[model samples]
Target chain A: MPGVVVVGQVARDLVLVVDRVPEEGGSTDVRERQELLGGKGANQAVACRRLGAEVELLGVVGADRAGEDVLAQAAADGIGVGGVLRREGVPTALLVDVVGPPGVRRLLEDVAPAALLTAEDVRSRAGLLQDAGAVLVQLQQPGPAVVEALAAARGALVVADGAPADARTRRRVLDAADVVRADGSEAEALVGWAPRGVPETVRAARELLEQGPRVVALAAGDADVVAWADGHVVLPHLGEDPVDPTGAGDAFVGALAVALLRGEDPRTAAWWAAAVAAQVVGTAGGRPHLDPDRLRETVRRHRGA
Target chain B: MPGVVVVGQVARDLVLVVDRVPEEGGSTDVRERQELLGGKGANQAVACRRLGAEVELLGVVGADRAGEDVLAQAAADGIGVGGVLRREGVPTALLVDVVGPPGVRRLLEDVAPAALLTAEDVRSRAGLLQDAGAVLVQLQQPGPAVVEALAAARGALVVADGAPADARTRRRVLDAADVVRADGSEAEALVGWAPRGVPETVRAARELLEQGPRVVALAAGDADVVAWADGHVVLPHLGEDPVDPTGAGDAFVGALAVALLRGEDPRTAAWWAAAVAAQVVGTAGGRPHLDPDRLRETVRRHRGA
Candidate 1:
């Protein structure tokens, strides 16, 4: 099977749970902790692989031990490692999610310049990207790398997530991606205003569809709106007051790409993606535990509702 | 030279600095990050070694990569690692210090039960501790291990820091230690109440001296009091407001031990410790960077003030 290629950050995610944050100069115990393979790109790749896709992660990790650890974890998750680059003399990117009460978290992202995807790193994997069945480009990477991935993956289905860092990249993303997805704030950055409710989100999604993408999915307030040229569906968010929302968007996009790859209708794929993302909102950290059978059952139930 | 032995926690310290903590469901980039070997025992041992004393650390770390990393760091710092036991199948303790502007920090400590020193682990190093010139016991370890360390180091000049865990442990610590030191809250736990100022601290210090420790040092408000059987001196804390106080007490304890080992009088040694602690207050993490000549000059300036 020609694998799906995920182009973005590959990092170590450390999730620490504390009852309450201590005052300055005070100390508190971590009630729970999970150190795992994570990063938006890595998480999405994990989600894709979990849903039975042969996936390749095309991201940069440091040549350090943590870089090796995350790569080992990714391989254990059944993601291909051939496209992954280990940059020398740098530290792996680290995402620390310190979560407290529901929806309360402090995210400390240590993303060094060298840890980010470089244009050179992407070009090195041009053949792999070009040969992919589908390409998931996380806009968190540098503009050049994101554009390069889009250019290389012209032969495959292209899905872009998050707001482009600059206007040139944003224009290139809309022109190249088959589908584009963003959360509330990212939508504001992409389209000049955040879609707050059903009417605004649907309107914004249509405007984005006009830009060139065949479909656009956006998180607006408590609902997710998925719009194509003809129609749009605004689905209510599944998890109420999510415990943590770290990886929900990644899972949402992964599910969409996976569903489309399996030939599901765009509307059903969008609903399926929303359902899958709902599962992640309840868990800590961004890594998805995607069981296709369960997700299908959830989508069926959610559609009935 | 007979070495100074330190018994307590050995952890990987991850210090992250951000301009402001992100709200619930928000993200922020860490402006500065420092990952190093830290924990009270390790910090004090580093301090001792930096001050030109041979030092050995007696602690438990997981038989994991992080454990190896910290052990390697300790060795690089010129501290003996033979007594640093690697417990099987556990994770090295991790302390994440998230600092914002001056004096604001949120500490998350992930210290697994197996990573803490066991009585058996302490006893295995009995000969090394017994033959040491001095022993610094950080009270963060379990009562049994702390007691075992004290028992093993009966021939060494013993200094105990922090509040003993239980009443029985308190009694054992007082009886076994030659010197005792406690920060404000720890002092309150050691005694019934914390000392607030010079007079109250002096009275409290005198009271503690009767409990078997030859010298008692207590942090009281902005001042530190060091008292012996017949004499006591109150030194104003050198730093106006400490930027980070995670390792202040550890450095203080280390400086005291190093000074006493070099045949300094109790008052001058206390003054020296206070001066050294002032230097650490200006930095992040608990690791001390001690320079004897510079520290001596700072002590002279501090005493004159």
Candidate 2:
């Protein structure tokens, strides 16, 4: 049985890279196209699974051809899909990432209502969520589902990802979460506004740490700040310009969860998260392709520096 | 056998309608998603086929899954796929039409080099092209392929669609063509500039007529001018807003060819083309779902007016 559970979206990700975006009534050719299994939940689960964290995903995918395809991919990636629900009468979610001109990206998401986990689905997966050593909940889902997942994972190292859908879910999540991870906009949803600079982001991360989570990670402009009870660490952005940043955050949180599950302290785990995230943005698409040994070397090098 | 042969691209078309396009680093959910067989060649072929014309398509698609899927769709639509070349090693072409706001569309085309018809591929289909009653060539393809298609259709009602790639191909097409249809931008390439009003479009059409075509159609701001040896007719655009204008021109030219093949006079055929174009823009995506009887009625009403 997998020791970790990921409760979030499982979608078909299509990446179309073009040299430049054309104006309205104009056209541009796509230089690269990648169709893969992706979504924050699937990406994070794949990241954790790649690092040898036995992981099972809890999410809803519509009963369509793409659903079958993504499930086959998840199984091949060594993640358990038993907890995934195939809701009838809808097509699976689709995320199209149009990357143009260096790091510019536009996203088109098709997450239908039926493709999202309902409270009923989360309740039905209580056994899977409760038995996991750690459970990560994507708060972007419906409020009821987010709260249900938080409640189901009683003693697990519960991690909350993204901003809660509403204030009620926010309260419930903070009451139960052991770790929190949010990107810029989501951090703005948690704190009053988006923090700028390393010092301001450190203050913001510390503010989140006071709201129930033992460790809090928040993204600043080009760097990340991770704060805990005693101290904090500010990680610089990857040196090279990123090919695509669509899935970097998911990789970071997944690495952070895996490191914590392996008994690493908060400081070392944040370093691991940063190193893994840097590797992910160096490639394209939301799904992470991880090499554990290489990632370890990168983390060690960064830490020594 | 169908009497119409369309020579150009064969691609998988994806229409994603979003409420609004997101800014950089932002995301928007797709309001609707439509995936189908599309391309200038395939769209025109489908339109001709729907009007009871026996149509065969000559184009190149990659030897990929999308190729197989689009070919299956063409076959199901009663268009002959015998002349469609399946080149290995390259993925099938994809055209993504992102429709936002009313009538605003951004096209992302993935027409890889291998997905385009080579001169060899076009030449190989000489028998099919020669046997057709009308052959429509999309000039957006490589120059050699367009020239080969024009040369092969020596005795057919040669129709050139879109802008020719180079001066040589343009001269060859003008010399060989019996009919020419171009939208505003393509009209600019044929002439020196895009015609602004109906009268200017009429002059542009007459100028094209002197270049060899017996019938020439040129799009102006909101109307189309169809010129012949004696006089010209300016057809106003469809009254309602277009849902997506991605394939309206393809439908117009296809309907025109079908009407002329059925022995309708140039004036009545132009009316049919206008009526069909109006109906096509009422829907999203490039593939047209045409009703012959309904369109004939609409054309009769418009022609009588």
Candidate 3:
């Protein structure tokens, strides 16, 4: 499949499991420490690729050690990082994480704004995007630049992951997308509406419709996902105890993009997307792959293709 | 002179700065971190008695934090963290500081570790050793208890800093005279050690001396100190140009045990301890204090004392 092109931040996630949150002036011992390759763009790209989609990722990483690791990881997974620009001297971005009783505590959060694909980098990869069925963009990188690139990809069906957006960024990117998937919090932040039950979801969908995207998918965890574009569709989550919920949303967006590219209708795509998300949530470290055959089998078993 | 009683791990000096060391997986950024008050016992007790030798610390902060901050610091400054046990939980502590390039970095490193201390919460504080001017200890509480309460007074000095050691701790104490001080790290690790130079100076002196006191005196930063067989001596490090040697070894040990204890000798007292060290290295955290006031003052002024 032509699959989805994801453009956004690619950062290292420094995860540590600490015994307890250190007291105001005290110290606690760290039980385990791990460094994982993660970024909204990388996660989404991996998710889509695992769901049988050819994925291309565009982001910036420094010429540092972490950058090399990301490049090697992407190459091993068969995801294209050709559009990535290697900036001289700028260090790769890092997310210091403490995962324990208090969920995850993020320390030293920084986004290197210059990592977004330059006009030249995007121009060089224009032919690749032109044939792609869908273009997925996340706002972890510089927002304005990704929006501009999305606007440039005329033939691709544009899907914006509006998870990390504010009113301004939403206003700027919402109209440029064919399909927009956002978590409930994003929906609430954009339109000041909370979609709870079926009726409320429809109201929320209508509100999102006013934002100009043809299809708006609002994922509300176990509650339900309400998508109304051409018609109303209620996609409820199959309950699974997710080990860590990080990157599950990215999985949903990527899977949905893949399903839509394969000519499935929004209803069928959303159902498959939820199935993919359920698998993702059940694993640890935002792991997107559970077993390819198993995922497809689960989707077919649950959704009855 | 019934010189300062240094009761911590007397070891060699090892300085491994962050910039010089190799980071894991190769490249990493140098975050502007502090030159921490590393040894729990040494820092706490020394911080308590900075003005002159009047300080005493307790506990086992290991050959690591204990040796560097405790024993070396005590001998240099002449304070005593009485019966400061030396064990091995970690290695000899190294304050791996990423000292900022030259001009502006000094200010930030000053306040960072300036407040740390070590106290002995596990050990009992009962009797004073023979003629002890003041007793000192830390609760860098190590496993396999080596310190126990002394029963004889003989007009010996005693001071115990009850910092948190092991959680389910058995109380072992040394008692009878003088001051006690504890701070954050000691409260957590329940053990402390002298920093780099302190242990080395003490080792040199202990290597030289044939007979010594039962009491201990540990000094940190600029605090001068001395401990008696039961009674400690007092050395003075009354010098200047101390831009960021913040705690001056707490001003506790050197202030009370050495300077205030009138019965003690002033020659090798804790008062002259840090002074001699300042003469050698010109700063509190620099080197071990030794020699008489005339020589110390000469070098101190030369080093911009």
Candidate 4:
């Protein structure tokens, strides 16, 4: 199955659960701790795989234990790691997340080998994107590499996620992508103004659509607005209690790409993406366990309704 | 120079600095994060190496990346790791320390391959302990392994640190050790009563002397008391600010063993140990950066006084 090709960063996340933020010089006790796989690109690849699509992840990891472990996990999850580069003398990227009650989390990240990924590395794996049904790229990678990957995915439905990026890269991705997904803050950052509510968010999405993407999806906490050239639709959340929302945006992008590849209408694809994201927030870490049959049933029921 | 042989656990510590302990169901933000090398046995080994002892570490780490990194660090610090075992299919021990305030810290540990160490593993390295001037063993390892190491260090001055251990293991270690060190709570747990002040601590140390160890050292936060067969000595602190005291006790043990090996009287050895430990508390982690010349000068000055 020629499925989705994802290009982005991969990292190991050390999670600490604490009660409150300590004062500047004070320390706090950690209630629980864990080390898990995380990174925007890796999370999206895993999300695509869990959502019943074949996934190829293109990224760079250090030539260390963390890198080996991540590649092992990706292979175990049935995500192709052929494009994953192991750079010597650099440590794998590490994200230390302090998660507190009510799902509050602060992140400190170290992007080592990630900074080593170059345009040449992305170009080396461009062949994987050739026959892909969709090509998904996250902005966490180096700007030139991201641009190279997008340029290589010419015939596929190109989906882009608004991870933190340089202004030039953001504009280039917006111009190249067929579909662009961004959270409220990311949308505001791109458009240079904060959108207040649904109507403002729709206005912002329409403004972003003018940059070249056929569809622009802006996600608010409990609401999402998707705009195309003609009109826009607001979608509500699934109302499930969220355990963690770390990778929900990536989940939405992954699912949206799959739905679009299946030739679903843009509005239907948005709904499917919202449902996948809701399921992701109810699980620990970024990758959620997915049941494709259950997802198909939900989609069928929604269509009938 | 034949120096000390240290047998115990080695771990990677993930330190999350927070302000205070959050309520049971509350979450908190992390102010900072660091990854450092730690473990009582490993700490003492590094301490001894820093204080100018040729040190050998006998321990087991997983055959994974963490193990390789730890062994590389030990070698870099001039601690011989020839006796360190690399066990397959197990992960290296990891300690997650959530530190709040100066004196409050919570430790969550995964012992992993450290727990897989067998008594035979210690026995195999008996040759390294035969000509060593001193041997230090921590209670963090398997009971049988600790006992075996002590048995193998028959000719050396055997020093023991009371880490968490069962009653029987505690008794066995005390019986096999020439010098035993414990913090207030550790001493209280072993002797069945808490020592409130200096007098009571000395009294308790004497009582523990009857339990088979030739000398017993009890460390309070700012004061330390050491009791041997003939008498006891109370040592005062260095009157300097302490930054982190995580490995101070191990520092005392390492320096005490070195002093005793040099034929210092038990009381003088205790004073040298106190000076070494005071230096440790001024630094982060267990192993402090040491200047051998400075340490020798300090010992000479104390002896002259």
Candidate 5:
């Protein structure tokens, strides 16, 4: 099945559960620990695959144990790995998530391998990108690779998430993406002003639209607002208590990619994306356990609403 | 180089550096993170190999990516894996070390595959145990496997470290070992009384000697005291600042096993063990990088002292 292609970072996430943060020179006991597969691109790919979209991943993983583990997990999830590169003599990227109580998590990241991905790696997978129904890219990957990937997916629907750390990459992403999904903080960083409420978020999203994406979706507090040349739509909260919000944004982008590929209207697609985010935040880790039948049922229910 | 055979657990250690642990309902940020090879058995085996012993490991690792990584690390360190078992469907053991400032660390462990080790597995390698110069066992493994490994090492000098959590396994380990090593707290747990001073530690070591071991060494604060039927010896500290003391006890045990195989007297062997512990505590992680020549020079200097 031809599906959306995702290009970005892939990392091993170590989650440690602690009661509270200790002061300097003090120690706290870890209540629980788990190792999981994570990274923006990988999480979105897994989300798409779980929701029954034929998904392929384009990224680089080191020839280390963590890389091997990531590959094994991606394969188990049925995501296509034909575009994944295994680089030798490098360490795979890593993320350490220290979760305290509810909704409190501190992330420590090492993106060594992610930074090593080059434009050559993306250009080499030009065929895969062109064949994809839609291509999703997270700007957290190297700027050069993201640029090359965006160029390669010119013939396909390009959905971009995340603001690059630098102005050049941010402008490049805004210019290349058919759809851009950003949270309130990211929108502030990209558009130069923080959106306060739903009205302001739509205004901010329209400003982002001026930067070039055909559609701009900005996730504001308790609501998501999207703007395009035609008009704007405000999506209300799906009302699920999130176990973890780490992967919610990626889930939204992944589901949106699938919706657009299925020829849904932007308003309906944003609602579907919100549903996926709700399901994701209700689960542990970045990759939620998504059953395609249940997801379809939820979408059908939302359509009636 | 048919050297000491190490039988016990092998684990991947995820070390997280955090400020003081958070309180219940609180959160903290992690300062740093690392992944390293660990486990009582793996640490001791690596220590012996670094100290120039022809070391072989007898343990089980899951037939997963973590297991593959552990094997690669063991092979790179020149430790033998011929006796290592690859079990299907189980995860490799993992230890999460949440470290605060110096000497403040909390351990959260999962011994999944280690617990699956059985008596049958140990008996299968009886020939390797009997042919070894000495066999080192950590009671952290499954009780049945520990018992079988001890029985198989009857013809070789059996050095046992770590007290079993259960009374039955503790009795069995004490009965099977030629030399037993335990820290002051563990010695107290095994003997039913906490040793408060050097003299009490020696008395506790002698009580442990009466149980079955030919010699018992109890590591107390600042000194190590060993007791045997004839008499006892107190070894002074090598006087080094320990960077992390997580594996110092294992280093002492591994080095002492090597020394006994070389026919050194218990007093001299304990001194050598002290030197090894000093080197280990001065390094990071459980496995210290030891140069055989440097280790020998330090041992020689200790003897002269």
Candidate 6:
């Protein structure tokens, strides 16, 4: 199978669960904080891997301890780390998180560790992108450079999660991507909505059709989704209390990329991806494995794919 | 002599230097990165210790690995950590930094790990504050709560380093502080300024008197400072090519608190603090130390007090 190449926003997520948000300058009593192997690239790459897509992670991590942890986690997830160039002088990027009440998450992240990926490293890994079936990119790392690399690749279907994108960034990405995935808020941002609700989000997704992605997946929290490509489809929410929605979008994209690689129809692929994402929600962390049978069943029952 | 108290934001700081800031949508390469033990509280307390102040840090740290490092650094600095309460639940607070060319500093900080400080910890450390000759507070920690604690203290000469303050916070602190220190930019932030040079900063210092601080110390980078109290005095900056200015402010405040405890006149003490701060600028990292002779010579040359 042609592999899905994930690039951009690599990080080691340090997660902590505390009683409350530290008051403005007020401190909290931290009960538990654990380092989780994560980054936008790694999370989506892991998502593709667990959903049974051959995936390769192309990025640079430091030669420091966090890099070792990044390699270990990538290896465990079966994503290629060999392409990950290691810089001896720099430390890995870190995302510090505070998981607050009702599952609200505050991410304080710095993506500079991935910034150490020199032009030479990018040049060296250029060939890997050529062989992949699909390429996924996030905004965490530098976005334009990744776009330049994607522009050079002819074969792969480009999946862009224009997350963390502002007006200018989204415009830059809309031109480069084949499938664009927008979270509820991002969709609002793209269409210039004010204090958006479900209808506004739906209206925004419809307007995104002009930007030219073949498919646009807009994930609205519990309202599930309303998507339009050839026509409109309202997909049901997984209907489970999301243990942690940290990587749900990554999983959705990963699974979607995998289905697309398999040459499934867009609707079918999205259904399969949704089922895979829902199953992942049952697990506590991001990018949990999707049992082959369960993935198929959810696809058949809900996602027409 | 009564000891000194540093009441401010305390957390571990990770410092990294890169070639240039990442372009709006692009990435840049990092040349060096390091984890330096720091926090405004930790920096000031450690500075006081280096300058020979009997100092105690009154704050909360998480029970995680970072907290352990914070504890160890405090021990090494000879600052009492008994008041450094370790709550079992939270991870220690952290400051992430990206410093660019010409020594520009951007504090990409997350105080999540520092959320562990509780009201109880503040209450427990109250008596220690009351007995101190001087107390230093920075805006890195919660403002309102810290202000309340200072308001309750009667004996300590409260020196509020309002380097990073807002109108509301400045007002609250002025009500409780004996002296409030602000850099030229910070002073301008309170009362807008278009100062051209030394005269402008001096003029700026005069404007800060309208605020509640009995004295205002305005620090201009590597230049003479203008202080307003009994009378105006100009203490020249110790000339040095600074590699990193991370803890210079803390060093200044720490040495100032110590000098006050030693019963040095204010101008003489400011000179002592300037020397210590100059030493910090010469060093590559935070909280660099200076012994008795180094302190005395720097003071004697100034001929201020």
Model 1 alpha-carbon miss at residue A75, Å? 1.3
Candidate 4: DockQ? 0.14
lDDT tens digits by residue: candidate 2, B60-155:
988877899999999999999999998889889899999987688989988888788889998898999989999999998999999999999998
Cα RMSDs, all models: 1.7, 2.5, 12.7, 5.0, 4.5, 10.8
lDDT for each residue of candidate 5 in A133-217, tens digit (9 for 90 to 100): 8999887677888889888898888998876657777888888899988776677666777889888888888888888988888
- Best by the TM-score measure: 1
Cα lDDT tens digits, model 5, B48-145, are 88878898899888898788888888989998998988998878877766666665666666665443568999988888898888999887677788
Lowest-lDDT window of 10 residues in candidate 6 chain B?
Answer: B21-30
| TM-scores, all models, native as reference | 0.97, 0.93, 0.56, 0.79, 0.82, 0.56
**Model 6, global lDDT:** 0.68
DockQ (CA atoms), all models = 0.79, 0.79, 0.05, 0.14, 0.15, 0.04
Provide the lDDT at A270 for model 3.
Answer: 79
Docking class of 2: medium
- Listed per model, the TM-scores of chain A against the true chain A are 0.96, 0.96, 0.84, 0.89, 0.90, 0.83
User: Per-residue lDDT for A182-256 in model 3, tens only?
Assistant: 676566654566667567767777777877877778765454454656676666665356445556788888888
Candidate 1 lDDT, B111-136, residue by residue in tens: 99898888998988999898999999
Better of 1 and 5 by lDDT: 1
iRMS for all predictions?
1.5, 0.8, 11.9, 7.6, 5.8, 8.8
Provide the interface RMSD of candidate 6 in angstroms, 1 decimal place. 8.8
Once fitted onto the true fold, the runs of candidate 6 whose alpha carbons sit more than 4 angstroms away are A1-36, A39-45, A52-305, B86-91, B112-121, B139-144, B163-178, B188-215, B220-230, B236-239, B282-285, B289-305
Weakest ten-residue segment in model 6 chain A by summed lDDT: A22-31
Output the TM-score of candidate 6. Answer: 0.56
Give the whole-model CA lDDT for all candidates, comma-separated: 0.87, 0.87, 0.53, 0.77, 0.79, 0.68
CAPRI level of candidate 6: incorrect
